[model samples]
Target: TGGSNAFAAPEAFQTRSSSRPSPPPRPDLSSLASSAAPEQHAVSSVPEQKAATEAGVLPLYKIALCCLLTDLKINCRDSLLVSRAQAPSLPGYLDLVEALQQRVAAAAELKDVAALCSVFSGFLRNSLLPSSCSPDVQVRLLHALAEVGLDQRRE
Candidate 1:
């Protein structure tokens, strides 16, 4: 019983497969050669392709703020469906706002964009300065923040 139960030998596995047909030979490389300079065109297309990619990606903070703003706006305007979205996750919402402010501040001349800055500043203040924090306060504060980012467009 022990001899019969012994595991198959390694040679047995390899020898068993020998009866199968071998794979076909690889194609001849010389016949596949082409004159097309795909590399040249690829190099030329890199920058344009990169810019197009960047154009497609809006700043995430701006998008999140836009979503939060829209949520607030719909609730205010009495649009039932849009207003029903779950409230923005607080930590994520705050981090997004902070990131947006930092990004905007770094990219723009703060002095020249004072008025625009104030709107965001005010929104941040309202979100923090209130004695009792509620979803309503957060929503209103976000509208003010969204307005600040939007205001930058006019200037």
Candidate 2:
């Protein structure tokens, strides 16, 4: 026992929470960590309303909804983001989310298959293709959509 020196500190230095498990690690987002918020793009009210109306119509709404759902299929392959796991019977509790999901589900009609494809292509090009993927890939998608009369570039 005298071979090694025993200079260790007393048990009073130990912490009480040392046995507790550590919290989950946070996600690392490059270049988005600063306290300064991202710049907000100003959207014109008139055009926004028009776009909303166009997307709200029976045909267009169906197309938009279907496209959105198809694109989100990858992310939601595990679970639905809009659907609640545990729900309550409260008035208008999740009406907006439910309505949106319903609209997307109702858009799967055979008559508007072309429109649905166009919407899907457009969404993939503008919203889904960029940022998450390389710029070169996004450009290729934009070109493809352009050939099909589906402009992927934002106005």
Candidate 3:
């Protein structure tokens, strides 16, 4: 006898959502979601060198390519788009990369704190901060660098 209720199948059918658009994101939920995550604008901002690092290709080589691109007044951001597989085929970057590596090795060999700092500053200026970046970008990049304080070690 209860099997007669089987005709209720139509009533159990779900309402179609096509007639109604979803509600817009609520400000509170949006703010909370944002708070739980990083400031995307800040996080996604490349600040010159980051774009290359994010490419996740031949890290140092691509990073140097980004730097070299900036030197040629080319936007390094484009170089960051190259895939890792294709990174070797771009140009003859090994020489430049090797020279930079040598400079890094030289810096690593330094026993003097001042010399090490000079090399680090040089890296920050020439490698990290591209000349093509706008002054505001430079300031933004410097602001990030400014957070560090060199520890005092007895000479």
Ten-residue segment with the worst summed lDDT in candidate 3? 1-10
Model 3 has an lDDT value of: 0.35
Model 2 TM-score on a 0 to 1 scale: 0.22
Ordered by TM-score, highest first, the candidates read 1, 2, 3
The candidate that wins on lDDT is 1
Which stretches in model 3 have alpha-carbon errors above 4 Å? Answer: 1-106, 109-129, 150-155
lDDT of each: 0.45, 0.40, 0.35
Which candidate number would show the highest TM-score if scored against the true structure?
1
lDDT of 3 by residue, 26-121 (tens): 677555554443655354455556644544433444345345434422343344224323333223333433444344344322222232233234
TM-scores, all candidates, are 0.29, 0.22, 0.19
Pairs that collide in candidate 3 are none
- Of models 1 and 3, which has the larger TM-score? 1
Instruction: Give per-residue lDDT, candidate 2, residue 142.
Output: 31
Backbone clashes for every candidate come to 0, 0, 0
Ranking of models by lDDT: 1, 2, 3
